[model samples]
Target: MITKKPTNKRLGEILRQANLVSSSQLEEALSEQSQTHNRIGDILVRRGWVKRETADFFATHWANLVNETEKPLKQPLGHYLKEAGLLDDEQINTIISEQDQGKLWVRLGASAALKGWLKQSTVDFFVEHLFPEQASDSPFTKAKSSQKTAKGRRSWFFSQMK
Candidate 1:
């Protein structure tokens, strides 16, 4: 009797969905893997597209999710930011309270940034790293991207004036 090997889910797809690897980066890694016959994770790491520890974390997260050994928590945005080390408990509480009081109408990360508790880049990093779906679906995210594009065009227009 022959027993077939159990196949694991695709790590590349998981990583891409997590926003750890862009489609272009994954494509490059796939191309390199085809040429070198190396594992995609190794190719990504070797090419400096992703850090080894990040790859390991996502791989482990996927394995745990697939094996039913662990269930991810659907926590509040403040909790997620606190867990990501981007916001302290006090800062999270402040943001939550402000939101509750109708004094703030932004997401947790944006609130933190607006309050000067965290840098915009720090919020962006944690949001991308920990909540890729939110990054893609968020209206705040869309506004931020549009703001960047407008800022770039305004700068170009001003630079041309000089």
Candidate 2:
């Protein structure tokens, strides 16, 4: 049996964190998987809790992304999120357009978070793991450190304007 990395979240956990499925639904699916001897992704897809592509992306491509250390990622964070079913083409286009209109340089992940399309933890996970080299340079990290209180939280780019 293939084992997942300790740092990597399971497919169900990822789906839950992304708010794609409810906890009760996941538990029910897990129960069915125990009796059906089927892949969790397949079970979820069959139940219509998740789209086929979304399940496939997590089952097939997620491991590759997590374990990819030899090759540097050429695509931006939005690409991965979209592939993972967390984002759609429209959202990606919107983010890109917004970035283009902004004067300051903001990471795509930061912009997504600002728009409430992604959670801070989710962005942090990708930046810290997938783009370790760029993590320190990320405005999210800088802002998180500087703003200890939630009310004071602001991206470095926005903070610079004041």
Candidate 3:
């Protein structure tokens, strides 16, 4: 089982960090949320600023990714990405099939990026933030250090999307 440290990050913050939604967009969603009492994810999806799956993914897993405690991830990176609504069944199957047939040594995140299903930055975000141990030797770690410096200035919220 995987366990995470406590965090105060919110869905909007995570989405913003991922470069999925802009600050103005998040502010608009929040303004609407104030009046409707609807979920921020729902508002963002309705506005088309973010995909339903992306919103759902962050809503579900942002906490686990930000936790400071080191816990073993029980599954591969693809598993969490799928649950985060980043990857679908067909995408996973295609990646696996290609790996088996071609004997490709590519990681799932790289495969997904190469196929254009996800941006490289998104995969990098998951690797650097969610699974730091796997990323220690990866070139992606270079960016992680820079991100940590910026992270201190960001505000966080404890509200859940739902």
Candidate 4:
């Protein structure tokens, strides 16, 4: 049976959990690796900062060492974070900015809507409960009534000034 991978909460946290080296040492190794433009695992091994076995282990396991594209959708949030159960559905739901190749899907959808590329029905469908019915003139004016009755929610709804 296959087991879930662990999440990289933070690089520092990973170092702490691994307990292979002190934070200061790890910080120094990380800094040196950055200055030398060398991979962290490689630099740590060269400096004897960590054993080859440990380096190899972290090389494949460390959160920072792996490329994001190496595993997409498999973990959704991330292989390390999600598989480790560190991320929840709510957190995953906020992934509006992540992109692949040259396209940002959310942005593309928004642009399409703004350009009238998408029908009002499509927007309503996509937004789910946020936007009310397309028929703003109908007795289903609960959206407007609510908009006026709740000042804060109204502001929240239309507060994008820029």
Highest lDDT scorer = 3
Pairs with steric clashes in candidate 1:
none
lDDT of each: 0.57, 0.67, 0.68, 0.40
C-alpha lDDT of residue 63 in model 3? 74
lDDT tens digits, residues 75-121, model 2? 55666777776677777666555545554345667877787987767
Cα lDDT tens digits for candidate 3, 1-162? 334446677788788777678899988888998999999999999998877988887887677656746655555566677777778767876765665566553667888888898887888878877776556445322333333221221111101111
> After best superposition, candidate 4 residue 145: deviation in angstroms?
60
Predicted model with the maximum TM-score? 3
lDDT of residue 31 for candidate 2: 94
TM-score of 3: 0.70
lDDT of 4 by residue, 1-162 (tens): 222243555433354444545678778877886788777767666877555655554445544333233432221112233223333333332322222222333332233344454333433322221122222333222333232223332243233222
Better structure of 3 and 4 per TM-score = 3
**Arranged by TM-score, best first:** 3, 2, 1, 4
Alpha-carbon runs more than 4 Å astray in model 3: 1-6, 34-37, 68-70, 136-162
Given candidate 4, what's the lDDT at residue 7? 54
**Candidate 1: C-alpha RMSD after superposition:** 15.0
**How many backbone clashes are present in model 2?**
0
**Model 2 alpha-carbon drift over 4 Å, by segment:** 1-10, 13-23, 103-105, 140-162
Q: Worst lDDT window (10 residues) for model 1?
A: 145-154
Candidate 1 residue lDDT tens string, 1-162:
212222276877766664567899998888887898988888878888666765665555535433432343344444544433345656765655665566755766787778887666656655554454455555343344233333343343344334
TM-score, cand. 2 vs. native: 0.65
Error of 3 at 32 (Å): 3.1
Error of 2 at 31 (Å): 0.9
